[model samples]
Target: MSNHTALSTQLQHTGIIDAAKAQQLQTAASPWWLQILLGIAAWIASVLIIGSFLGPLLALADNNPVRTVAAVALLAAAIWLTTRKQEFLQQMAVAIALAGQGLLVYVIYDVSGSNDETARYACAVIAILLLLSPLNQLHQRASLSIALLCLLSLVSSAPLLAVVSSLLAIVAALLWCSRLKWAGFAQAATIKSLLEVITLAALALTLFGQCLLWLDTGYWLDNRLDMARALYSALGSVLLISTVFWLSRLATVPSRLALLTIAVVLCILLYPASGLLVSTALMLACFYGCSRNWYALCLLSMLLAISQFYYSLELNLLHKSGILALSGVTLLAAWLLLQRYQRRLV
Candidate 1:
């Protein structure tokens, strides 16, 4: 063949191969329904195996070799099914669901006098792995659902494990949601889902701490207080980290407003009087810096008003000091709004 003809033929073959590969890639990515079905199947298999083995092992440790063997067999089958899928959605959903159910089973067994540290550690590791899996929207949603279920299960069976798992799940969900490149309702839905996880986790931790306190004993009280303090510290750290991340995601005005609101609430909930004053000052500074936006100025004014009212009712602050702070915030807000209106008219 002529050299020119040979080069042309080679190029044609390369193009054909590339086209075929592209088609194959598209085909490999299955529909969301199929992925969801596969995930459900894997979850069912995992539950059957883990539940059979764990329940028998916990309740009848000596006489249930059959249940234990069956559980192992089922888990192996589920793992095999999960490994067969290379698609992001299928693999992630199946793996996360399986891992979540497995963790639930392990917690049940551990709390039932088995007291297996190894099992608990394994569950934690698996849960983390599931959270870290590469998945599309369907898989991420499945993973979030599974994680929430696991959180609820652990709450009743193992409070400490529940807290750790829930926190990790919340962080993972938020990270995953932030990476999603969706628009409109889809994006809003993902953010709402993540916020729900956070809210649930916070409520769970609070309830768990309160329950411990109600159990009654000096030792229990001391431990409960320590746990509450630890929880508050952890929440403060999360809020700080979240604020920093969100500042990058949010508009300037909304970012400042959110940070100010969060700081005020955190100070009231977690800090003493001195910390409250410091946080209030910080919020005032943030508001002042971002007062160009009317919405931000309005939010700041409302916050200041509430804070002043609460402070007056709760503390014997000098009347002049209270008056000065309130007056400053009011004047600043009025000036900002007037400037904004004038600019808009111009």
Candidate 2:
């Protein structure tokens, strides 16, 4: 056969049409690409229209009834757009929601008359939007991460509150992630991917704060909030106890004992980072007790723990060395105990 005929046969077998048909196919594809371009243009157009509506409000130079109306109108339109089933509209809705949220925050920033409160209120607004919108929607749930970040931003002044917010985000993330165990929930691939990424990102963020220089963990630490320490410690002890109790079944007694000893050492490490260490350990223990799917959580926990311990300025080299030595001995003992118990009991 001629080269052209041979190529044609091969192409036909591969389910591709001849060059003549390729022209036709390309012509057909042009409209789809055009549609995509048009959709993008539409999204931009919607944003511009909303910006026009917000223009006068911005000139108001401050938050007032007019700005408030614009903000609410944009939000309501964004929400209304989300209910539209058309693909183009959905994309437009995402843009509108984001822009609307920004406008709302701007108004709030102006009304509050303080840039300091912006993070907290922005987080509050996003949280409200998340709860109001469909949890299964990727965009709505995904944006919640901004709020999680606002909480992390609080670490500079309110370390305890920051930790509390982190804890809350983790708990909420896990509760949502737990649904992934079932076939029905697992079918929503986009939702699952978004949730896992957001949750892990948030977890990493929570750990990131510990890398900072904390006043409570330094020699010249703030003694004013020693009461904060007392409260955190009390809660930490309860967490430790419950954590041990939960691990009682899965872990050998020696393993649990090792873990308990480590918890005690961490609590008295005279480092606020230790609070997170205990909390992370407890969270990991909970994950392991509840699901074998906790490998990611465990890995993240270990990584964050190592970072916190390593960067801990208050933990001198000698103290860090001692902690590591005890950890090794405890682990070795636990391994031996587990082996003996397994051989004897099982």
lDDT of 1 by residue, 154-267 (tens): 333233533453354345334434433332343554554454444334434433432333345353223444455345445434544454345435435644554455445444
lDDT (10s digit) by residue, model 2, range 140-183: 55466656566555454334644463454445344453554642
Q: Name every residue pair that clashes in candidate 2.
A: none
Clash pairs, model 1 backbone: none
TM-score of each: 0.38, 0.57
Candidate-wise lDDT, in order: 0.45, 0.57
| Each candidate's clash count | 0, 0
Which stretches in model 2 have alpha-carbon errors above 4 Å? 1-70, 84-92, 111-126, 146-241, 249-276, 282-286, 289-298
